[model samples]
Target chain A: MSKEELRMHWEDSFDHKYVKLKKWLIDGMTNGQFRFGDRLPSENMLCRKFDLSRQTVRRALDELEKEGAIKKVRGSGTFVNRVFAQPQRTSSVGILSTVLYEYIFPTIMFGAENILTSAGYGIEFGITYNKVENEANFLKRMLEINPMGLIIEGSKTNLPAMNVDLFREIQRKGIPVVFIHNQYAELSDIPCIIMDDVGSAFALTELLIQNGHKKIAGIFKFDDVQGKYRYAGYGKALRAHKIPIVDEHVIWFDSYEWLGKEMNWVFEEIAECTAIVCYNDQVCIKVLAEMKRRGLSVPTDISVVSIDDTNLIANLEVGITSAVHPKEIIGEVAAKTLIKMIEDNTVGNKSYSKVMPVEIVVRQSIANRKKMEKHHE
Target chain B: MSKEELRMHWEDSFDHKYVKLKKWLIDGMTNGQFRFGDRLPSENMLCRKFDLSRQTVRRALDELEKEGAIKKVRGSGTFVNRVFAQPQRTSSVGILSTVLYEYIFPTIMFGAENILTSAGYGIEFGITYNKVENEANFLKRMLEINPMGLIIEGSKTNLPAMNVDLFREIQRKGIPVVFIHNQYAELSDIPCIIMDDVGSAFALTELLIQNGHKKIAGIFKFDDVQGKYRYAGYGKALRAHKIPIVDEHVIWFDSYEWLGKEMNWVFEEIAECTAIVCYNDQVCIKVLAEMKRRGLSVPTDISVVSIDDTNLIANLEVGITSAVHPKEIIGEVAAKTLIKMIEDNTVGNKSYSKVMPVEIVVRQSIANRKKMEKHHE
Candidate 1:
């Protein structure tokens, strides 16, 4: 069919002019009007035939070319290619998580899916399960795919170093990468989305102190970067309140398995304490269970508080008072900032990071021992 | 400086041809060698002078042009524009959540951020706070930003319809959108990442029955879509064991606030039951607290179990046995599916949904009442 004939068959129901033009061409091709090796109308011809701009015609044609519906010869003209039997794999973004099915990671992954998919990009996902070797392997595999961008949740980022050169190699290859939750010290040049762990931890400790708790115990993770910062905040809060950092009251676990095996250490730390500051809800639960086994009640015998205002704490009848982790905002900000870097084509150009603010959630796990003292007096 | 002079000044340490060219141009401009509004050497001249291909020279020029360092007039050669004062705002992806700072949403937001940012796209976030009006307003506001794509967590999606028209309008406008958690009935055409609520709830209920608890009470939410599906699962489990769905033993709460005020209902329901099935950890906690107040111990007087394998129950001394929620996997799959739709440009073209798999976490809350009866005999 002639270009004019094809233009006349275009539907106006579709609001997008490019979409309408695209549909018309697709319909004509499907009906065998446009065949293999057939030369389609030139950009100028289509502009006039459809009463459209050269830009609009070119856009429709560009899409057609991408889907292998057409091909262009530099000095010649546009010719119809075969109708694609299989869809093409376009540009993609990769997301590497330490753990894929636990805590906040799932939601973060879902959030990323929402943005990337809508923007017409594919996703490549990998799980490190918080292991250094797994992270290395995942990064290597991701490099082979060479996605448009990469999102990495660092594994054991609290350690002095691991996989810095691998991350640098990705940058050198012109691929944009952003870190989530934690980042390595050697990879300081990389942008990361992090929680305000220090501040929130400090606030949680302060909350316990305000309730008249002089002896406090702390449980922290040794492998994650957030644990270090949170511990720092814990120390700051203790120093600020004129309470010495009690060495015996502090415990650090390397992994969940380690924590499970070292339940005795938790007991040792909490023996002389009136309040306990846990690394997260998981630690809080373990400590609570142990306390209950020994016939100790929450807040009355000793107050309990932790960071991360998750359902774990929120679901309790008398919920564990917590300092909120700005989980969603961290995801949003990190995605935005990284995208800005990629679009600006300045990946590896400069370091950018965001520390999201947190809030304290008050609940029944924290009690005012001062009130009891007044009754005793 | 002339093209030959610039070529002679090129450094050997820079690996990328574009990087070398960019650095040369920047240095020349800063040193007044290439002044404001000055025209640069032609692409052919640079290729010849630097012993590079025309493609290489052009690539360098493209980078310079993107940075606003040079402008090419229709007939005129490329000339210096100006140093970029600030980076431009690139295309953005939008995320609309029911609540931005709440438990699961934050992590989801963070995950999305990790993906979007790395791909070189910014994020525009909005929160519905689980209110229909808020959802409508956020959707409308998101339209104003004209994001490349959208990810929405539906607000109370079980009641048939609320924002169907608004969501349809978004799809009609050619913006890709994917839902998380729950989807409205009228908008079934849109894809959603959901949990296997029915199967998981059934497993949880079956667990209680397996422990010889014939009388099982239930607490659920009325507004959220998951509540209904979970309730269905609960009934199926009971019927499988030939236990009637006791009307008085099932209580549904609208909001967390409602659950707090309706403790009496929970107490009443559990009065004659040997076990209870809660919608989530929050309800489980409330029941545990009430049970404690009445001097009732878990798995002794009554067994308490819930869905969602979060730290809330995990941290308890006698943790609540739970059916795990595939939180991170949900995000990953949802984001992947949505991206597939967008990249294929099939927005509103097909219906896609994924019900993530779940696992039951066995904890100490459940007791084998059959053994207790044998002991009594």
Candidate 2:
């Protein structure tokens, strides 16, 4: 580059609209290099030196403040991030989940954190909570921040196309995005991090069948491919055993529910059903809690099984038995695959699918009905 | 306030970097608005009419995408957010938890979602994960796209201060920030959301005494006031009953188990105590898991009481008894106060410590040691 161009580049770098003044000071200090706890010049001095508005200068300083590059006391002045080094930011990955209100998201997030942190990725999350706009807003925001890779729990539908625009944006920007649960049907070529919902559901249903539970129910929500896959597995298990699919035993809600009224209706309808398998741990908790209220002890008078084991059940007096969702593995795979996608720019390719298996944790929660013929409680 | 200024704002609204050319088309639609499902004009028209580079013109459409405002198919152009009530935003409040990996941060965030969503605020999050620099970066990025408010879980001793400089910048720019856990000690006037650690700790200890467990062990992180409060409370609880504080039973690990191998030595020292009360849930989880490996059962052989009850314990098989932190209330208060700070531009006020009471959940984990002669399976 010419000397003039070099000087121009230097000026442009110094004149960065977002962090102009801070950049200049830090660059100037680069030779002297500000160490931890180095006091920054007062706001007035910075404003005067940069010939920039106080607000513009504040932006750079604020960035510095958040970085702990500097500390600011109300009456006192700004100082530097005392413990900072040349930051090694690679170990951080972003996890974008559906919602924050749902227990499943946080529980699944817990698992993801365990695997990612153990494998050396710091976990950060953006909560979509099933909203397309928020998801898109977060995505646009995410593009600007850019983590190592991203794990996105795909919506059942194609994000109604709008909320999904961010998915395309994620693709266009060459950021890796691994879809969770239902793959982005529209973007079928992208790899997804998933669970063995089909296998886990089949195994749970088989367990119930082996335990002599002929009258059975599969609890789920409508419109989700994951839930649908579980239902299909349930069918596969029942069909193999020569049992007809009972329409009455197929119970579903528009959303996840274990409310007393909802459970009561199910119980009243399927009075003779001996066992129930649920989509996730939440439904299982509700089912058990409702069953207990009705004086129906688990595994004795009635047996209950669920997909998705969570820390929630581990805290219960009677431990819940069921295969847990592979949240961590799925997160890791999703994170890794997304990073790969970002590197390869594989947004338009055939979507990838991942199905992790679940493990049955047996302690209590499920018992054979035949053992309770002459017993109570 | 002036007519010329109003005109400038009107033009600026349309000309700002974020403004999309499609907005102009949408505005020009019949009845001065476009209906849902109405197909937008082609990009050529946008480029020609707006006199913008295709890259610049595409941003307006991009906003709609992330927001799920419009749907786009490959070979097909963009459509609107299908659940589109004519471009309505989903109601959500975003939380910026410092570190997503920590157990306490999740617990607090869980509470924030509970209160905010119920109050008609949608939940979202930006994670600094306790890195002051990362925190600053996220703050700048978040500012670029404003959320309703932010609930922040801050870092502990010697960790980077969150964009304190940026937070002031945020205040200058009229954004609300609720600092939770570690609030700026020097900036007492800054709005913060936190629990009454001392009160709750004292209460937990008192509860143990009331439950008839006197020979107790206290565990906490050495730094941070929360630990100090728990220690003080333990001392207070002991003093209330005229029992001497057992110096040997107090265990503190200051530096990320900077104690590492010596963690065992500390654990061994505390094992002799009959009843153990921990500062928070993570410490409880670690301590309890370690104890079980050593063949000790909870509540029966050694009653363990945990502070900060999360859903993990309530649904746990062992039923860890714990004190509940008012996450939603704290988050709500912090947010409201931050908003106030943002609006008022006030400086130099001490944090109004809102000491909420902690409820002790009587779970099976806290056992009556006198009744257990055998180990729990």
Against the true structure, whose lDDT is highest? 1
User: In model 2, which regions exceed 4 Å deviation?
Assistant: A1-93, A100-124, A143-148, A156-162, A256-261, A315-318, A342-352, A369-377, B1-377
lDDT of 1 at A188: 81
lDDT of 1 at B94: 76
Per-residue accuracy of model 1 over A298-374 as CA lDDT, tens digit each: 88888989887777767776689888877666666666766676675555433577777778888888889889889
lDDT of 2 by residue, A1-377 (tens): 65466445646764565455667656644433554445678889866654556887788888877865567878877765442222322445677777854666665666667656766667677876454435556676776665556777754331113344456655544455667777644566666667787788888888888766777887765435576668767867886786656655766553212242257767776787888888888788788878889998876667777777777677877766687776656655665565555445344244555667567777676676545543645
Q: CA shift at A354, candidate 2, in angstroms?
A: 2.7
Docking class of 1: incorrect
TM-score, cand. 1 vs. native: 0.39
**Relative to the unseen true structure, what is the C-alpha lDDT of residue A20 in candidate 1, on a scale of 0 to 100?**
88
Tens digit of per-residue lDDT, candidate 2, span B1-377: 55556445545764664363545544543231543445666777666554556886677777767766566667876654332121232334457765664655555556556656666666667775444445556677766655555666554422113245566665433345666765644345555556676667777777677666777888765434466556666767776786655545766543333224244555667766778888788677777677767777777677778887876466656887777877656665665564454344332145544456666667776655433423333
Question: Chain B, TM-score, each prediction?
Answer: 0.73, 0.60
